[model samples]
Target: MATPHTIAVAGKGGVGKTTTCGMIIDYLCSKKTGPVLVVDADANSNLNEVLGVEVETSLGAIREEMAQAELKGTIPSGMTKADYADFKFSSAIVEEDEFDLLVMGRTQGKGCYCYVNGVLKSQVDKYAKNYSYIVMDNEAGLEHVARGTLPHVDTMLLISDCSRRGVQAAARIAEMIGEMELKPGKMGIIINRAPNGELDSGVKAEIGKHGLELLGVLPQDEAVYRCDCDGEPSSKLPQSNPVKQALKGIMQELGL
Candidate 1:
């Protein structure tokens, strides 16, 4: 088990990916075992909402400086861009109980974020080594890591709704993974908002074609919706909630 250092959660929008990520974080925190780092790589910035953290810092500002550093080549002679990039990591990290979070807010311009996002890759890769588990709430797609921004992860959880579009999106993401050659330890599907029953024939077949393990499914739960409306943290979801129980199955299946 190659350390299982980092886990990236990705999927189509409205797939409850962020909520799933939060549940994973909750599971990690329950253990008296290790530190958990939550990385929010979504431009929409909802991981903070799921985790119930009012984010005060983000990777955006440091990206501005790294952009300047890369363009000017003024990072103290002999230090590689990656070496100078470490400082940005220290400054960018935001710590909290049981973990820290690094939120990648929106990118402003049309130009690429190559300079800083590149630096972020190595920085996060190094930071990952220190912890037992790292949970990333990735974007709608995985273009960031595919383009070499976020670090190589262990398991990539592509959460999807129980819909044809979700199934198709999962297939496309698997293709993207191959094209990028980001050989994660494993990749799988977490079907959210699906009824707890035998997998639908078409759904099983679609998932089969991709060779992705059906990690688990979270049935539609009003607990989630009601709580969300009230701004309650997913991690603190009541034990009676079906969503929490479903997520427990997910983590157990993954051996988290």
Candidate 2:
């Protein structure tokens, strides 16, 4: 199935999932790049940081207040579903060199973020229709997505590090999506920080066990770590970066 939306990356923390997504954004931004909308669904969104943009309002906050306002039946004047969605549109898209971003920050401890997530997903669907592509840096769990943040996605990239725990997290996300059976346009897996030389046959088997396609492996990039330490724009990663090259390879295989 041909999908207009390019991709979404989800996986365990510390797996370099965010960096991979940022690299994809950098690639897409550099090419013909009509407006591209990036939705940072992770509560701990540093996509803004990776890309070197300041993150402002988060979508979670907007929805929380919107729900409250709706309950009061006194929504701020000029706020209807249509108006609200528009406000969300205006609030979310952070303009940069060639890309736009919509951040959904970490949920407050109040409760599940499923409600806010649903609204975001809805708006994102509508938002994507207007752009050439949408890149979502998703939250850790696939629960929100399973609940319908994005029932149908173009491609869901499950990322994991070379650890058993990271691999387990990816497996769980895949299982969550599978249990929900929310058929996406396409979905796959990409293991990061793969060990070199001596094989951990146990770990390798665990990766192969998943039904999703294995896209590629990314060696831990010291450049990325250094950039983060200095708060640099990861999008500007030199072509010599190993992870950057691996990400490009993954994108090509996905036909982006």
Candidate 3:
């Protein structure tokens, strides 16, 4: 089977990373790019809300259950613990028409998570071959990257707002990628919520100083804000929405 094209989206909090990641997933699915796998690796885990999907379970929850299952005697007879874990992990995937979402939920109530994390990685690797693309919304801390958990990254999109601090945070992430030697096929920055889709001179200077590539800019669009306020999915935004259009163009430029 062919390997999936993996895309990792990362940024500091409040930079609209999840929203932009949702738009990318929606665009890929809408364009019929092929089956996509969406991974919400962010601990806060709101990618589903942006995509208008509901998730009842997560890998973290399954891990916790498995941690205590032996004591509780929940593993069915004739099923190995690994087999039971596989079954539970499969149930955590939230299947949608366009994509399947796997949320790496936050660890709870403290215990060594290494075993479950290994299982989750194995499951992701198994499922990855069945998709054309895998889009991940990562937390600002790059926990997956630090742990070397992602199967591989084809493209890394670092999201940032117009603020200097946001750009600096993105630059730091870029630096971490280099330090970790996780050389993705491509890496660039997408400046979101830019007023009129234009960057200030200082921000431009900062980008140049950090040597970060500016993939594209998404203008501040009230439509996106309105959708959030109305409890609607960002994918529900009209085709004319500037943010959507800008993301489409960015994806096209990347040959996605």
Candidate 4:
């Protein structure tokens, strides 16, 4: 087994970050790059929905169950606590044709997530070598990265809408990544939902001010909007669809 290339897509909410991640996974599968491991590190945990997959459980849910079961001494008679946890963790991964989805669900009535996070990190480390690429859709902020919930990123794609505030938020995340010394091989910003696939001059200026690499701009496509409205996976968008095409081009530019 070889090390996998990990790509992390991050942005503020409502910026189409998850949708972009779905498309990236679709593109990699379409190209027959290799098996992809998709981790939804977002607490909102809608990556499965965007990918048209049903998730029966999440790591957080499993963690909570393990904690309760331990308190109640409900571990199976033969299996040790570690074995039971491994069983539950394996069950949380939703396997798909092209990729496997692991969602980090929200904690409920939690004391802290430190234990579960360790479990997730170990699982991810164990499973990572089997895939050629690992793509993660992260939470709005850097909580996942700061907490070391996921693997080191190879490429970091920061997403932003055509707004100054969105860019500013992305810039702050980029800054935090630098301060944390993640040192991703490639880091850039994708301006999504740009009208007519064009960036506002002010937005360009903002990007310049922050010194963020402009990876590409994705147009606001009606097809994508309609797919979301219909609860269809954006990956189902046709290749000729503007959003899909634009993203494909960007990925090509990145040599993915």
Give all candidates' CA lDDT scores. Answer: 0.77, 0.75, 0.88, 0.89
Q: Which stretches of candidate 3 lie over 4 Å from their true place?
A: 111-113
Model 2: residue 134 alpha-carbon error in angstroms: 1.0
Candidate RMSDs in Å, in order, are: 3.4, 3.0, 1.3, 1.2
Stretches of model 4 off by over 4 angstroms after superposition = none
Q: How much is the lDDT of residue 26 in candidate 2?
A: 88
**For model 3, how many clashes?**
0
- In terms of lDDT, model 2 sits at 0.75
TM-score of each: 0.85, 0.85, 0.96, 0.96
What are the runs in model 1 whose C-alpha is more than 4 Å off?
Answer: 1-4, 65-88, 196-199
Q: Which pairs of residues collide in model 4?
A: none
- Candidate 2 residue-wise lDDT at 247: 78
Worst 10 residues of 1 by lDDT: 111-120
Writing each residue's lDDT as its tens digit, candidate 1 over 1-256 gives 2243688887888888898888888878886468887888877778878788888656766676777788887678888876776666587777888788887665567756665566566667767767788898877877685686767778888888887678789878867876775777878887887776245678877788777778877787777877689998877787667878877877777777
> How would you encode candidate 4's per-residue C-alpha lDDT over 1-256 as one tens digit per residue?
6999999987888998999999999999999979999988887789887789999889989888988999999989899988998898999888888899888886688447666667777888988999999999988875867776657789999999999999999999898888775778889999999999999999999999999999999999998898889999888777898998999999999999
If the candidates were sorted by their lDDT against the true structure, best first, what order would they fall in? 4, 3, 1, 2
Give per-residue CA lDDT, model 2, range 1-256, as digits (tens). Answer: 2235757877876777788888889888877556688888777778888888887788777766666678887666866776875675567667777888888875566778776677777777766677778888877775566676663577888888877677778888887877775666787778777654122567667777755577777776677778888989877898667777877887888887
